[model samples]
Target chain A: MSDEDFQEPEVLLPLDAWHRAHGARMVPFAGYSMPIQYEGIIAEHLWTRESAGLFDVSHMGQLLVSGEGADAALEALLPGDIKGLREGRMRYSLLLSDEGGILDDLMVTRRADDFYLVVNGATKIDDIAHIHEHLPEELTLNHMDEQALLALQGPKAVDALARLVPGVEALSFMTAGAFAIAGVPAWISRSGYTGEDGFEISIPAEAAEQVATLLADQPEVKPIGLGARDSLRLEAGLPLYGHDLDPETTPISADLGFAISKRRREEGGFPGAQRILAERAAGSAFKRVGLIIEGRQPVREGAVVQPDGKITSGGFSPSLQKPIAMAYVPAVSAVPGSTIAIEQRGKIFTGTVTPMPFLPHRYHRQGSSK
Target chain B: MSLYFTKDHEWISVEGTSATVGITDYAQSQLGDVVFVEVPAAGTAVEKGKEAAVVESVKAASDVYAPVSGEVIEGNAALEADPALVNTAPEGEGWFFKLTLSNPSELDGLMDADAYKTFVDGL
Candidate 1:
C-alpha cells in the first residue's frame, strides 16, 4: 500500500454535526477531528468568562472499576487516599511509574458501588493496559466508550444548568450525583478545568446532541470549542497532560503535591512513594513556577529558560490580556518575585515568576461567599 | 499606483519606486483575531519571498513574506497600540511597512487583483 493509504483516518465525535452546524472550525487533535473554534477564540473566551459556555469534552476516557477490594487495589497504584474517599466525593490523583515518574493524572470518584475514573484522551489506551496489568484478576474494569461528556462553566453556569436539571444547584465542588436531563439519565459532577463554578455531565452518546442543544438554548450559554477551553484553563493555572505533565515529570516537581493525601504520605505504600516523600521534605531539584512575560509576544512551549529549565505550557491569557507561562526552574530561583529569562525563535524574553491562577479561581466551594 | 499580490497572500501597492505592503483580507480572516504584530524597522533590507513581518493570533503565529526585494522606510507604529487593525482593516490602515523598491520589474511577476481573487477562490 502507498504511504497515503496507510495513514489512519481521523475519528469523529458524537456531536460532530452539531459543532459544524454551529460554525466550528474542525482540526485534527489527539487522533480525532475536534472543533478548535467558533465565531473566534478571543470572543468565545471572553463570553465564557462573562456568562456561561457549553463545551463538548466527550473525547476524555471514562472507566468504571468495581469488585471486592477495588479501592485498596487502586490505592496501590495511585498516591491519593482512595479507600478514604467517601461515596459521591471526588479526588484528583496521579498514576506513577515504578521509578516515580508520572504516567498520567486523573480524577477518581467513588460511587455507591464502583469507582469512576476520568483520564486524558491521548493516554487512555496506555492507561487501560497499565491498570489491567497491575490490578488483580478479581476486579472488573469497564470502559464507558458509549458515554459522552459536556462541561458548562463560568460565573452563570449554575444558573443555566439548574434551569435544565433542577436540584443541581445544591452540588458543591468535588461532588457528583445521579441526575436526569431532558429525561435522559446522566452522571454529573460539580467540577471542571476552568477556574469557575461549573459541572461536568456524562450521558449516553446517542443523547449527546439532544443534551447539547438544550443547554445551548439557555440565554447565557454559548457553544465553545477547544481554542477557548485552552485559554480558559491556562488563565486558571491548570496544567495540561501532554504539555505540562508527562512521564518524565514527577508530581512534586509539577507542583501537584496537594493530590497526595496526608494518609498516603505517611503510609508510603504507593508507587514512587520513596522518591516523592523525600522530594516533599528536601524539595525537588526543579519546581514548576508561573511566569508573567514582560512583552506582548508570547513565549510558547519549548522555549528555553536560561541555565537549566524549559517552558512546558505558555500562552496569552485572555483575562489578564498578557502572556503567562509555566516553566520548570531551579528550586532556589523559583520564588514568586524572581526574574527569569527565556529564549524562543532566537529572541530573548524576560519573565517574572508569579503565583499561578493569574486570575483568582472562582470555584463555588461550600460556605464560600461569592 | 498598481497593486500586486503574492501566492503567500501578501499585497503590495507600488507607486513609482515606493511601495507599501500588507496581508490580504483573506489572510487576516484565516488568522482569526490578531493579538500581536512585528514588522521590520526603517533602514532594514529585505529579500524577495523572505519573511518580513509577523502576525500572531490568539491561537498561533504566521509570517508575512516580502513580495519583492527592498529597503524598509517605515513600519506601522499604530499596530503597537492596537494590533486588531490587521483584522478590522487589513488592506488599509493595517499596512505592515513602507519600502523603497530595489528592482521595480519584480512587481511584474506578481498577480493582479483579479488574478489574486481567482487564486484565493481556487484555494
Candidate 2:
C-alpha cells in the first residue's frame, strides 16, 4: 500500500522526486514513502558489501538538546552518561521505559555547542514525547525536522566521502563533525549499520537533492534501496527496531550493554537500570544470536526456532552467499556453534547460532594515543 | 518451435524431445536482483506444475516450478555466484535448465508467449 494510505500522517523526503527518477520502487515505511529497491535488492546488497551503496535515510529524526540543565535532564531519561561525553564525540545509547525495557536506541552526539541526537524514524514522535515529559524544565529539545540524512556505506565509502567532504577523513569510527560537502554545510559521522567504513551525512533538506545527485555520479556509489539496506544490516549483525529490538527486549538481553556507560551502571539513575544492570550481572534468560542457515532456503521473520527460540530478523545475505538470520533463544542455546532448527512453511531448516557479524566489521578506528 | 509458460512465470521453448527453460522477463523484473537459484539436479524426474527449483531475491524467496513433466538434463550453475545473470538476460544466457520432455502434449495446456504477456499485463 502507498504511504498515503497509512492511518498516521505521512512525511515525504525532499529527494522523493530524485528517488522516483532513479527507478526506485517506492514502498510505505514508517509513515513515509521510501525506496524499497532500485535495480534489485540482491545487486544493491552485493554492491554495498563489495563497493559502496548510497541510502536516503532522511526520514530518521534529528534533534538538538540544549540549555543549562541539558546533561542532567538527559541523564534522567537515558541510561547513557551524557554528562561525561566529550565534545564532538558521539555515543550510542538507548531510551528506556519506567519498567526498564528499551523504548528506542539512538545516537547522541556532543556538538561543539549542543547535544545533537539521531533517532529511529518510526519511534521519533514517541521518543520526543518521552524526553519532553521526563526532562527537567531548564532543558529544551528542538526537533530538527528540517534536515535530511544519507548513509554512504561499504568499503569504498570513506574514500568517496573524503573527496566530497575533505575533513571527514580525519574522523574515527563513531565520531562526528561538521563540514561542508560540495560547498553545502553538513554534519558527517563515521558510522553506519552496514558493518563497513562509511559516513552518515546530515544536510539541510534543501541541499539533499544536490548532494544525492553528486554522490550518485561517483562510479563507486550506487543508489541502494531499503530492501538491500535491511539485508546489509542483517549481515552486519545490526538489529531492526520493531523486529529485533522491541519494548520487551532490554539492552542487556539484546547484547547492547556496551551502549550503557560505566558511570551510569554504577550510579543507577536511568529507567530500568536496576533490572538492566542486574541482568548484566546475573545474565539474561534469552539472548539474541546470529544464524547461518544450512541450505539455500531462507528462514524468514516470525519463523519458529525450535526446540525453543524465535527468528527476529532473517533474509539471504548476499555477502555471505547464504541465508542468514537473527534469533532470540534460551541463553544456553544462543552460544556460537549451537545447532538450531528453524521452521519455515511446514519444513524444518537446520541452522547454527554463529557469532554476530557473520562478516567482519570494517570500522575505521583511530590509532591509540599511548 | 513453440513457446509455453507456467502460471509460476517459468517459460519453456520446446524443440521436439528437448526444451529450454527459464523465467519470463516479467518474472525476473518482478524478482529484482536475483541472488540465488537452487537449480534442480540434472536427471531428476520433475512432474508438470510441481515445485522444482527456487529463485531468491534480496527481499523474498520464490519457488520455480516445472512447466511440464520432464527429466532435467542440464541446469545452469553460474547463477550460484552471479545471480544477476537472470536480471540481465532472463530469456537468453539466463536460461534456468534444460529438460528432456516426457509428456510433449502437456505443453498444449501451457500459455503461449502472447497469452502469458496478457496474463502478466492483467496482473
Candidate 3:
C-alpha cells in the first residue's frame, strides 16, 4: 500500500473551526485534530492558574450505561464502588484488565436515570468494546458522540460560570447537575483534570460553538489549548492515560489505589480483583513517584532513572517554574525525600522524590477554606 | 561577517574562521517558548548535519543540528539561566555556541539570507 493509503485521516473536533480562527496550533492527538496551544503554552497555563481558561475537550468519550443491573455490571469491569455512588456524585475509576493491568482511567458520575462516564479519548473505543463483552446483555451502553465536552478551569472559573449558569457554584467538586447556559441544555460537573476549582460542561455538538463563544466572552475566561491543559494537569500531578497509566500498569503500581473503593476492595468482585488485592496487601514491586529535577533542563518521557526506573510523564512545570516528572521506581526509592539520578542523552541529572501535586491542588471542595 | 542558513533552521554568522550559531527567527517562532537549551562545550568537535545541541520548549525537546563541521569555542551561558532568550532575540543574543569552522568550504552548501527566507516561505 502507498504511504497515503497507510495514513489515517484525523478526526476533527466540533470546535475545529473555532480553535483555528482563534490562533490555535493544531496537532493530531488521540486521532483528532486538536489544538495544542494558542498564544503559548506557558502563558496559557499561567492564565488558567490566575483566571479562567476554557478548554475544548470534545475529543473525550462521553458514555451512558443504563439497565436493571448497570451498577453491578460496571463494578465488575471497574474497581470503584459503582453501586454505592449517589446521584450527582462522581468518582475517579480505573478499567482493569483480567491481569490487573489498567485499560484506562476514567470519571464516573451517577445521573438521575443512567450512569454518565467520561473515558480517555484514545482508549474509548476499546473501553466500549470491553464493557460490551463483559456487561450483561440486558444493559444498554450508549456512546454520546454528539455531546461536546468543555472544561472551564482555574481559580476564577466559578465566578465566570456562575454568572452564566447561576446554580453552578452550588455544585461542589466531584458533583454534577443538569443546567442551562444561555438556554442551551448542559450537564455541568464541578470537576476537571486540572487540580483547580473548575467545571466540565457537556453540551450538544451543534450548540458547542455558541456555548464556547459565550464562555470566552466572559472577562475572566480565555481559550486554552491542549498544551496548557497538559502542563496544568502535570503540575496538578494528575496522570495522563497513555503516559502515566497504560495496559502494563495497575492501579496499585500507578499509585492510584484510592480509585479502588473501600467496598470494592473488601468485596473483591471486580476484574483482576485477586491480583490487585494481593498487590494492595503485599505492595507492588514498582511504584509511581513524583520527581523534582534540580536543574533547568527538563527530563522528558523515556528518560531512564538510574538503577531501573523510567519517566512516564515528564515536563517543565509552568506553575513551579521547574522541571517535574512522574516515574516508576522501586518501592524503596519512592519516598518523598529520596534522591534519584536520571540519565538522558548520556547525561545524569539529579532529582528528589517529591510529594505531588508539584504545586498544591486548589480544588474547591465542600466545607474547605478557600 | 557573512550570514548563512541551513534547511534545519540553524543560522551561522561567519567572521573570519570564528562563527556564532543560533536557530533562525522562524525556527524560534516555530519552537514557541524555549524553557531549556543544552549547547556543546568549548573544544568539542561537531560534524555537519549532526546533533550538537538540544532546545527544549514547554512541549518537547528538539535537536539543534550543527550547520557545518566545527570546533566549538563557547556555548551561550545566557541560555543556562534564561532560555527564553531564544524566543526574544533568537538571532541577536540567543546564539547557542561559537565555533572555529574546520571546513569553510562547506559554507558553499548552505543558503544565504534571501535564499533561506524563500526556503522557509516554501515550507
**Leading candidate by DockQ:** 3
Q: Write the per-residue lDDT of candidate 1 for residues A1-370, one digit (tens) a residue.
A: 0001123336898999999999997877777778889888888999999999999999899999999999999998899999999999999999999878889999999999999999998899999999999999999999999999999999999999999899998999999999999999999999999898899999999999999999999999999989889989988889999989898889999999998999999998999999999999999999989999997888888999998899998878888888888999999989999999999888899999999888888888988764
lDDT of 2 at A239: 90
Output DockQ, candidate 1: 0.36
Assess the local accuracy of residue A196 in candidate 2 as a C-alpha lDDT between 0 and 100.
84
DockQ class, candidate 2: acceptable
- Scored on chain A only, each candidate's TM-score is 0.97, 0.95, 0.97
Per-residue lDDT tens digits for candidate 1, residues B61-111, read 778888999999999999988999999999999999999999998998999
**In every candidate, what fraction of the native interface contacts is reproduced?**
0.28, 0.41, 0.54
Task: Give candidate 2's whole-model lDDT.
Answer: 0.87
lDDT of 2 at B15: 92
Candidate achieving the largest lDDT: 3
Could you estimate the TM-score for every candidate?
A: 0.96, 0.85, 0.97
Candidate 1: which pairs clash?
A: none
DockQ of the candidate models in sequence: 0.36, 0.28, 0.49
Q: What clash count goes with each model?
A: 0, 1, 0
TM-score of chain B of 1: 0.99
The residue ranges of model 1 lying beyond 4 angstroms of the native Cα positions read A1-9
